[model samples]
Target: MREEPVKTKNANRLRDERRNQKDTRNGGEQTVLTEMDGIKNAISDVLEQLLNAEFKKFVWHLWNGVGADIERIPRAALENADRQDVVDRMVQKYTTNAGTVAVQVLLNINQNDLAKQLEVKLQKASSQRKGSALLITNIRFDKSSQRSGAEIDEENMEWLLGALGYSVEKHTNLSGEEINTAVSNFSKRYEHQCSDSTFVVIMSHGQRIQNKDAILGVHYDPNEHPDDIFFVEDIFSHLNSVSCPALIDKPKVILIQACRGDVCAFRDPTNGSFFINYIVDMFSTSAHKYDIMELFRKIASRMQNDPRFSQSKKLLPCIERTTLVKKFYLFPGLMK
Candidate 1:
């Protein structure tokens, strides 16, 4: 019988519920899709504008260096420009500057470019079959009665080093006299742990002598002669002996982060010379591009410019090596 349109009650309820759920899901999905498309378009436009602006700026800088008016160069010259042409011009300009041409190139290459180049060089060095090991040591002692401000945060130092890939062993509550003994014992116990491809980093405070030598991290009481200063060289010197064969022909990196004497210097507050901070920053940003020596030189330069370090009349870092070339060679070399 064609009775009242055979509407099954249960089927009608199920159909309504299914339609409502689908509509809800689709509405949410449409909102998300629209938001994502807008974001994508905005990012694409920004990137394109940035790239174009940089290219135009490069051209302008090149024109200025050559004593040519940028206005004279047609806008069409830069539109759809050849990247190779820009690079070639840069090389030519650099060479001209090198040859004592009095032209000042105004290329605004960022520090990031420098960092990338250094990373490439480091990667290349590391690839050349050099050994690779990580070393860390943290030594802390009571501040000398004479030195009221020289406090060592041994716990933080140890934690920081370990974070930087070092195996840390803590020597607690040791006196200056006990330091030497502890270091000696620790060295003997782990001498075999180091390989030719090892990397060693020592963190502590010390004095800078003649802006050439760095003394070890130790506190000397008033009236104690400067000779009482413990030099990092002493601790590292033990590793130099032929008897300790594990470290021979290896790359050792010693990082000292303490004031070298009370000779205060004016340093730039924005970029002061905190040795540990500099080390961490440099390694994190440019370690891939530069070898240890080059990286150290940059850090030293940064320290010099820092106003907070202006009082550092002659603070310098010391590197003693039997063979400078072999010792400073970074593993994996520079990357292409």
Candidate 2:
């Protein structure tokens, strides 16, 4: 009887040990699976939050006139929405706008199929008698002195203008009086030079005070006019229809690279100053006949939308006389 009882007890203990082992194994597997699920959920949540934040930032930047660097965004991110659909929507939006449609569609294209039918609009535009371009850059660090960048700016202007087939005559370090004299000489020379299509670009250090506008430069001659004088309106006014009938009705583009007032803060890094660079890049790559005003607007929009230049509100081309809404178009190469 004692042997029988011991045998039974051993059998029961063995069964209990086996059951405990199985339970322990199951518990460990459950714990691991639970931890993995939690980690997966947490990761998903973080990605969702990040994507939402970035999208909001992009929209905000675009609306504020600071252009977002679309290229910087990951392709996977943009894949959320069909890229073709997005582009189509953007085209529709731009084309439907009041002034945009008139200039982009009506003036440029007589019919809807015309622009699309052309294999190369740039070549076509180029074939229609090459026009002349003139670029002027004047950077005066102080009222009395001119910086090296001024000359560099002028040289860049000359090269770019020359490439565009303009007989460019660039001048640097000219005082206010000299500018007036140069303008007069330019007017006379310009009339004598290619009397067909012409373009003039002026880059300088300018300021807009209450009602008066001023362009600063160095005075070389003592007998010359004052260095810091108000001649902004006077200079441009000279290019009136009556003054230059040959240039009348022709596209006369003027670009001014200067500060509008002393209230601007130079807190942004130099790399952020991409206005001139962007213009150059666009000009070089542009294969179609682009409207100058439209180009300026696009540049302004890009600058205003970018986060790096969020603080800059005054960096825009001050256009007068011409209707920018009616005049701007990108050349064929730069368009698509």
Candidate 3:
């Protein structure tokens, strides 16, 4: 083969050996390790382990196009891509179909930090329920008031919490000041110092003031006086790790079955409050051994899916600041 004469400018690189490892022998295309390439390598390393068969299974029910995308580009194809484009096709696929599944599946992966955190939460919940207590403040007005069908919720909560093996303290018709005192005194209980967890249920009418959510006592009427309301923050702050050191590492299980603001759902007007109905229905059949959050998730799911309210109303319980430092279980062994 005749050697072709190299141009002077191009020959300088070969003579000086200054051009970085490019050679024309085998269609020379050198891979450069840029900062972005490093990041891509790191991310791909993590994602290769994350987007496994387990994750695909975890979100099979939630994601819309995951199955189709996985089918369109076979796993074998993804495995055979060049280094740079290995994750590129996948990134495009997930972006096009939306990544709701990818994000949610991160929480359930067995070895990921999120799944480990949830495991810690589960550990705190898995202990025996022999010592915990559920304090329920059930306040339905004395016949003269307009709110009805609330007493049914009070009864149902007792039966459910009792079945969970929580020693129940039922307080009826407490005034605003009395509610404060009841909760304040409850926070100082000797049992909390040694108990695994505590459950507080306050069923009443509530309205927000200056954007702060507050629960109303039976005395609250159209006047809306401050004395007749107990701010929800007070409940949380009162039982916080600082105020009540006894509950420092314990789960403060709170369920407020109250109307926040005036957001009312059109119901049968006789069956019951929408939130309570779902709560009772779900808790009645709660799993014998599982996390309390599982029961909570079920209630939220049913509330969103219930035919009557799905279009009109959507309700989710406000779960906050579980500083238990571990997972918890409310394995109330029987459905009483």
In model 2, the number of clashes is: 11
Could you give candidate 2's per-residue lDDT for residues 20-133 as a string of tens digits? 222233233211111122323322232233345443443333233322322122333334553233233333343322122212322222333432322233234333334455
Q: Name the best candidate (by TM-score).
A: 3
- Order the candidates by lDDT, highest first — what do you get? 3, 2, 1
Give the Å shift of residue 171 in candidate 1.
2.9
The lDDT for every candidate, in the order shown, is 0.40, 0.42, 0.54
Q: Write the per-residue lDDT of candidate 1 for residues 63-181, one digit (tens) a residue.
A: 44434532223344445555544433333434322211111222243324433443343333223433332233324334431221112223334433433334555543334354566
In candidate 3, stretches whose alpha carbon ends up further than 4 angstroms from where it belongs are 1-127, 132-145, 222-226, 265-271, 332-336
Q: What is the TM-score of each candidate against the true structure?
A: 0.43, 0.50, 0.55
Runs in model 1 lying further than 4 Å from the true structure:
1-164, 190-194, 197-231, 259-273, 307-322, 327-336
Worst 10 residues of 2 by lDDT: 1-10
Give the Cα-based TM-score of candidate 2 against the true structure.
0.50
Off by over 4 Å in 2: 1-134, 139-148, 190-196, 220-227, 263-273, 287-290, 312-314, 323-336
